[model samples]
Target: MQTLVQTFMERRGDLLTALWQHLGISMASLVIAMMLAIPLAIWAARRPKWAEGLLQLTSVLQTIPSLALLGLLIPLVGIGTVPAVIALVIYALLPIFQNTYLGISEIDASIEEAADAFGMSRMRKLFKVELPIAMPQIISGIRTALVLIIGTATLAALIGAGGLGTFIMLGIDRNNTPLLLIGAISSALLAILLSALVRWFQTAKPKRALTVFGVILVLLAGGGAYSAYANRVETVTIAGKLGSEPEILINMYKDLIEANDSHVKVTLKPNFGKTTFLFSALQHDQIDIYPEFTGSVLETLVKGTNPKGMTAKQTYALAKQRLAKQEQMTLLKPMKYNNTYALAVTKQFKQQHHLKTIGDLTRIEGVLKPGMTLEFIDRNDGMKGLKKAYHLNTTAKSMEPALRYQAINDGRVNLVDAYSTDSELRQYNLALLTDNQHFFPTYQGAPLMKADFAKRHPQIVRALNRLAGQISETDMQEMNYDVNVKKQSAATVAHRYLVQHGLLKGAK
Candidate 1:
């Protein structure tokens, strides 16, 4: 409960900003839709032949998959709010246009004739008679569009269009349930409030209520414009590798900077592949920094993928020298934990075969079910490479993370790719096979920053580097246990750990 309150307080800014963006997107889409739809509806109503074709076209646009439509717009429009708004506007059109047509066309012909007989012009008739009568239905359509758009706008986060969806995605990524619930509940409340306002507008005296509403909207528009101008932050993109440990290190820096100075923003651009791909991103300046294994860097990048024999510290020092001189990158202190890959067999399988190491696995290699992620299957240093290097040609089975966990737990798979510090390995009593042949690369975590960035944010560099050589395999597993098994929030876990270790005074 305390954790929940703390998280909410911390994310209050994010919540407000998300709410504002969602409201802007929703209201803007609705207004533009009403403008185009009302006219289109009237024109289509006047021309019977065009009505069917126009409705069909609107339906077709609605039928285009939202994600696919967003993808199609990327080349032309690029990422962020514009493409998100376009997709939402297109989505809003069908219900709005259809209802506008229905509301106007459904009006009694006697009423129209009565208006005409009373010497009213066409424009006057539309305003005094048709529109007033259609007001309820038109507002209903607006209400529907608002609700649907709010829901769909959550997808905008995927394309960097900031909204409540940002929190939702982050929550899922870090398995933070409080954040997920907060995001979902907040979005729901926004929808309900907007829907209620629309319904009230439908019933209330428009001349008075709408006048007041219009004034409020104008003020909001002015305020939004002012806020946008005031908060025009020059974006400093910091991209990096997608490894779990790298993300942890980068997030630490991001939190620190964001807490102390809000102007400079650090954005993570994650590479899904290995050290080589991450280095490539660095060279291209796509990612500013990521935690990398120094040994891999020395062997892979500096030595051209053929580093023969160097101790962990030696390799790291070499990598530090190479990156500083050649690539203009700086390697910070190395963390104690080395998340090198480990092959693990279930306790049952281990006991049955008396297996403790790779040598014992040689006898039953052909019969063993070795579970690996899809990327692991194709990675050069993954399952196939490990097999060639270690001569354990176990029968490989590709499975996702969730499925692999279940497979190993259910004893369906005898061996799997277990990170050295994975909390679940101990939980399930899995026996890690020692790589006697040393097939895997050294994977000690180290933050790699751009040299210029280090110069600017020396304090951030210091804080992160203090964490180096601190987290052991046991420490990380315990942290993961607190986070995943105990279901504590990652930020809370991080803060608590930092406090306990004297890295952050009063952090908890």
Candidate 2:
């Protein structure tokens, strides 16, 4: 308990920011749902057949997985708060709509007759008699929907939408129980408090309740507008892929840019999504820049033909040239590390099997079960390349980068693909097998952006390139270890590295 309290205190600011984001997003989504559902529900109550179809539609929406829905929204609307709210509103609509419809349609016919006998008009009866009588059920539905929204709002962070889910996902990625518990427990508490508030609205005077809701809407709008205006100097959205390394790198980009240029504001979208998602976002101008890899550029993004025997420098040069000519993208100077993919096994497993090379996995063919990431499993320089070059193949279960470590640690799998600079390798005491056949290409991390954006923002490019050949293999591994194992903030880790390395002057 004391340790948890200490952790909470240390991360109080971050926790509060995430909680506020979560609450605002959830509340905004619920309000939007209420607006859409109330009218639709009234129409449905009038036409029973249409109401049934509307119910079926919302039920189908409920059946769609939240992550899948977000994925679908990305291509249409891109990411961030927009898609997050849309998904949540869709989920919230069903409950609120159903409840509203049931409350109105199922009202006692005796009341309707009484209202008609009193000469109460249709609209008057709806606002006065029927609504007052059905208020309980409507409020109950709102409470249910609010709880659902609060719980699910955590996933919003996965798409660069800030929320408590940021802590949860970061925790899972770094294997930190403190972060996971903080996010989960906070979310549960938020749901309870908000549900209580909704219940209170059931008893409050209509004018008072409406006033409070109006105030909330105003606050949300005012806050968003103010934030936008404050950050209007020169907004540059910088995104990165999953993992502590990318998060750290993006923070470095943010810190260095802000330190170098006062007018430039760098907005970091850390853990934005997959490599392809960020690349697409860059192409579409949804984001300004991101940290990409030379190998991924060569194999995954460009879809270039097979290239072998290329050194790290050669890879960087080719990636820069091809990105400029083929894709009209800019690949900035890479860092000193080669964070290429490698296969790893536990020290015990390596010793037991005498595995020194990737080919050694063939010795345990049927016995070897490898845990890898989906991108790695499918990429040409990953599983495909391994099989083509090493003549080794196994039934590999694709999992997140973090879970692979957990699987190997728990003995569920004997093998896992890993980045060269992954701190988990140090934490887990795993042995990286030699890629004697040189299957994986050099993965030099660099700042990637549209060539036009690069040309326009030469200062931004220069600020980012301050890191060129600066961070070495050991430095990156330790930084990852700090954030992933030592439980440090990416911003702090990044800022400290920059200051110490003379890449950044004053902390922003």
Candidate 3:
């Protein structure tokens, strides 16, 4: 109860902000979808010859996976809300188009003849008779499209399109349950409301309501103008990686800098994922700062680590030393979390087998059901290294990386790869095997910055440094528990930690 109250107090602002964002994205998609679909449907209905081809084309788009569609758009349009909107609009077309086509085509030819006999013009007859009859079905199609787009819009977060999806994805990554709940529930509610609104439009006399809607639109246009005028400030563009943590870091930095130094405007241009890409962006001056893993920088970026053995602290120091020579790059202070990997087993299996360390598994290697990702097996410090270091070659099961735990509980696999700080470790009664051999390289979380840029923004360095030496195994476990199991928003939980630790002055 105490935790929930504290979380509510901390996350209320983010929750509200996310709500507003969701509304904006949902409505914008609906409006654009209606505009495009209605015209296309009208054209197709008037010329029945084109209906099959148009439907087939739209259905082909639907066949393409959602993620693939989003990825395909990324290079053409780059990242942010535009690509997301475009994808959602494309996805929304089928429902509205099909409904509109069917609604118009199904109208009785007798009615059309009757209207013609009354000496009405073709346009008048089409509008007064066909359109009115089709309105309900058209509205129903819009409802279906709106619901589909609303759900699909969650994927927008990956490209830095700010919506409830940002919360949900980050929450899942960090194991924050509250955030997932908030995002899921909010998305569901938006869909329900849109569905209800469509029904209401069908039942009620809509001429007056539509007039009011138009008025509201005009009012919003004016309000948007006012907001632009009021919030107008210099823009400080910072480009960097887009990931669960880095996105939040950029957002916080933007808020802090703008609040304290309003004269210096702040804008975020995110190109998320993969350390190599982030470093390249930094070198080209495309990004100002990004959160990076210290050990990853060492092993993957700066200086490759010893494949045999190296402590987390040692790996970090090695990375720091190597990066210090680079004129353009400067590694910032580390974050409170490590985001490292671990090996886990079900507690019952652990107790039954008396397994506590890698050595214990060597004896029963032939019988144990070991599970690991395909990628994990190839990486230098992954399963191969584990087996090489421990001399334990277990014949096992291969499954999807994310579903390893599910495999374990379903009695498919007895041993699986697990992250050191994963939330599910405790929730599922899993026991982490001691990595006494130090097979896995360190993956400490850190802030990497541009050398000259850091000098200009001392406060950014200060705020980040405050996070140093704060995150530990226990802290990470608890945070993961809150997110994955307790159902909290990552932004909320992250903000609370920053404030409680006095890393920042106010809750965001």
lDDT of 3: 0.71
Ranking by lDDT: 2, 1, 3
lDDT of each: 0.73, 0.89, 0.71
- Report the candidate with higher TM-score, 2 versus 3: 2
Candidate 1 residue-wise lDDT at 491:
59
- How close is every model to the real structure, measured as TM-score? 0.64, 0.93, 0.71
Candidate 1 local lDDT, residue 9? 92
**Which pairs, if any, clash in model 1?**
239-287, 239-288
Which ranges of candidate 3 are over 4 A from the true structure?
Answer: 1-12, 112-125, 166-182, 203-206, 215-231, 234-289, 295-330, 333-339, 346-348, 354-416, 422-430, 434-438, 449-459, 462-508
Best candidate, lDDT? 2
Off-target runs (Cα >4 Å) in candidate 2 are 284-286, 303-309, 325-327, 388-393, 499-508
Q: Distance (Å) between predicted and true CA of 362, model 1?
A: 13
Per-residue lDDT of model 3, residues 164-214, tens digit only? 886676555544466567778888998898788668767776696697568
Candidate no. 3 TM-score: 0.71
User: Model 1, 161-277: lDDT tens per residue?
Assistant: 667876676665445677777788888999999899888777788697779679758976986889768648654454334333444455555665555555666665432234554
